[model samples]
Target: MGIRLCIGSVNPSKVRGVVSAFQSYFPVSDVRAVKVETGLPPQPIGLDVIVRGAELRARLAMSGDCDFSTGVEAGFYRFGSTYFDVEAAYVVSRELGESLGFSPSFPVPPWFVDEILSGRFRELEEIVDSLYKTENIGEKTGFISLLTRHVVVRSELSRLATLMALTKILNRELYEKGALR
Candidate 1:
């Protein structure tokens, strides 16, 4: 039987990214996006919180129904006086193996970061949608693409992060030998 892949998000971009990344390694039999709560603020503002949030979602989304589960989260990182956009990815297996990966960060507007940190903005996605008068831009290029002029898209970034997070499973021996346990 082909592999069954599940992602802990309903966002079409995230689901597609996960599926695409795993497809290179396996012939996926079934791919599904399950909505799961990430017990974190809507707009997580730090590296630790963002990674933890994704791990939580991946672990929770296993639900014993899929061979592999993945979680993808996008957040901002504060370094000195600048805030950069980051993508965090987590993958889990029902057998208790897991891995984490991150994508490159790009600088965001200082004022926008200030507004978010000050709690004046609910979330980055909302800000992007409101400012550009766009609806659900996230499933496509997203705010990053608009800012970068499509040099990269959210789905592309997510796919790369997902691939990195699968390293443990890709090696197989590391996990099978109980090195991670």
Candidate 2:
């Protein structure tokens, strides 16, 4: 039977990234997507929170019978007066292994950071939508795309992170204890 690789999120960019990563790593695998709650804020903040969200989703989504599963989560991080975007991915396998991977970060507009830090608005997507005059852009190009000038899209970042997580799964000898930590 072909490996059934499931994704814990149905966001278009996430779906594309997970599917692409699995296809590239194991061409014969069957990839599928499902909407899973990360148990995090609608829009998470801080790197740790985002990574935990991905790991939680991956663990929950992989509970059923499946060869592999993954979850990708993105969030904004603040340092001093600067804010940036980051992504994390978690992958779980039936062999009782899991791993985490991170995406390259890009700085967010200072003004937007100011608004978010002001505590009036917590969801970055809403702010982005209002400023860009768009509707739910997070599922499409994503802030990553906009910030990077499309040099690398959201899917690309997610895919890179997925590939990184897959490393521990594929190389069990290097990580016998566990990967998801």
Candidate 3:
């Protein structure tokens, strides 16, 4: 039987990314999108929180029928005085347990971070939308697409993160032998 997968979000970009990533590795028989709560703030901060959010979503999306479930979340983390935006992907399977992966980080302006921290904005997308006069930017090209001049998009980020998370599953023998541990 082909692989059956479920994703914990209804976001178009995320769904496309996860589906594309899985298709690259396996013949996915069925793909389902479910709206699952992350139980996290609109804008998560810190690496742990971001990863936890992904895992939570993945776990919530898991079902008896699907072979695997996935969740993807984006947030900011600090390095020195700079805040960088990053996306986390978590995959859960009955046999393989769980795997986590992250996308490349990009620095966001300090002022933008300040605005988010100050509670002036609920999320970075909101601020970006206001600035660019674009609505629901996260569902479209994403802020990164604008920053990189359309070279990289939100779906690409999700795809990269999902691929990374699937590394262990793709190389099951190596992982079973603790190659990546």
Candidate 4:
């Protein structure tokens, strides 16, 4: 029997990222994409909340049939006076337990953060879409693509986060030995 993987979201960028990341380390045979609620605000703030959202998604996506489940969430984290956008990935498996990873964060524009804080916009995508005149940018190239001129797309962020999360699973012995504890 081959490995079966389930991703918590059906978003194209997230699904692509998780699938690509998993395929890099495992010979995945079956992949399923399901829509799961994060039970978080549209734009979650803080690293803890973002990780929690990912954990929730991962746990909710788990089923009896799949060998593994993953959740990917993107949000903002504040550092000093600046807010940076970061993506978090959480993976869960019966054998490996669970692990969390994050992608490199990039500072978001202060004005954008202000808008989010003002309750004028609940999600960064809303502001970006309105400014860029694009629709559902999150499902496509993503705001990161726009900021980086397509050098770093959303899927890449998700993929990197997932890879980082899988590190613990890949080196299970090291982790078990308290290398990361």
Q: List TM-scores for all candidates, in order.
A: 0.91, 0.87, 0.95, 0.96
Candidate 3 regions with alpha-carbon error over 4 angstroms? 177-181
Top candidate, metric TM-score: 4
lDDT of candidate 2 over 65-162, digit per residue (tens): 67888989888777877777877889988774889988887888887767776875677888988888877777887877677687778888888888
Name the runs in model 1 displaced over 4 angstroms. 172-181
Candidate 2 clashing pairs? 98-179, 98-180
Tens-digit per-residue lDDT, 15-124, candidate 1: 88889999988889998788898779988889999998889878777776798999999888989988988889999987647899887788988877777778887788
Over 4 Å off, model 2: 177-181
Total backbone collisions for each predicted model:
0, 2, 0, 0
**Candidate 4: what lDDT?**
0.93
**On TM-score, who's better, 1 or 3?**
3
Which pairs of residues clash in candidate 4, taking residues 3 or more apart in a chain or in different chains? none
Model 1 earns a TM-score of 0.91
What's the CA error at residue 64 for candidate 4, in Å? 0.3
Ranking by lDDT: 4, 3, 1, 2
Off by over 4 Å in 4: 178-181
Which has the better lDDT: candidate 1, or candidate 2? 1
